[model samples]
Target: MTPEAFFFEFPDGRKAQVALGDRFLVAVAPYRQRTHPCQVHYFSSCTGELREETFSVRVLEEGKEVLKAQVRTGKDGFFELWLPRNRRYTLEVRQGDWVAQGALTTFAQSPTCLTELRLSRR
Candidate 1:
């Protein structure tokens, strides 16, 4: 089955599309093991190229970051963070040299829910 897809809307009215499965692949560092999976997508108007990256997702409360222990997207084009247990936290997605950073408040119980993030350009 094809994975669900979501869109990241920017403040400038630009929307980038990301796939929850195929487009978002995870690769662990140091061990380079495939751990968590995420949803991510990246595109540049100047370069006109799209790349995908994935990484582990971590949920941070106040200031402490707790790894959600799930594979997340962190490629050059797309990324996602899986929140644990539905709480107010910050989600960060960095792809390749380009980093699209945004904060999303979501819940872990709502697995099928879509979290909207406003990311700044690199």
Candidate 2:
């Protein structure tokens, strides 16, 4: 008895040619785009209300800074940062004397990982 073979050609100029038995399974892992979302909210502790503030956002991987940006919260006191996936990262947000720190671990399956941070000061 002889086994059969199949060929698969991907659009990215990659080809997979393999031989298989009668009962066989073909598993293919395609390319995926992974992204991590980080949201920051700022508020006034004395007023207990949301405030639009400019913040310095930093993303660190393995104790080394990879991304740094000066972002300002929207009218709703919200700001978002998008990062790459499949990494454990340390996120830092700072504004004046108020600072917030958090960590996020992104997964390949769930590309859109959301991390929320709140910073408030009197």
Candidate 3:
């Protein structure tokens, strides 16, 4: 049998998604990532070393922007984001003259934690 997915919603209209039996994952900010039980996507943005720096993140679908922010990575060289389930998004991260681009899919079976988004000089 498959474990069912669920959501947590707050009075302020913010929400999070999780699956039954899912282990806890932590989040950090500019988002402050305070929304617990999030469908956490943890990323390390790196350039030869773990870094704490400013990044512009743009999440898009079908050429239209959905979520966009300029956030700084935590001291551990990580940042977190949450997205709605079962959709594909284009993620673009920029820092100065470097850029990293990738695809993200929020499928129920997708990975919740991953390593670096390696940036390349542009």
TM-score of each: 0.35, 0.49, 0.59
Q: Which pairs, if any, clash in model 3?
A: 29-32
In candidate 1, position 16 carries an lDDT of 85
C-alpha displacement of 32 in model 3, angstroms?
A: 24
Model 2, which residues run further than 4 Å from truth?
A: 1-51, 108-122
User: Model 1, range 1-122, lDDT digits (tens) per residue?
Assistant: 01245567889999887655423222122112222232222223211122333433554677787655434333333333433333565555443443333354443223332223323346
Give the least accurate 10-residue stretch of model 1, judged by summed lDDT.
26-35
Best-matching candidate per TM-score: 3
Q: How would you encode candidate 3's per-residue C-alpha lDDT over 1-122 as one tens digit per residue?
A: 11134466679999887664433232233222122232344233221234477889888988899989987776755665666666777878887777777776666665554343557778
lDDT of 2: 0.48
Poorest stretch of ten by lDDT in candidate 2: 23-32
List of clashing residue pairs for candidate 2: none
Comparing 1 with 2 on TM-score, the higher-scoring candidate is 2
Which has the better TM-score: candidate 1, or candidate 3?
A: 3
Superposition-based RMSD of candidate 3 using all C-alpha atoms, in angstroms: 9.9
Top lDDT model: 3
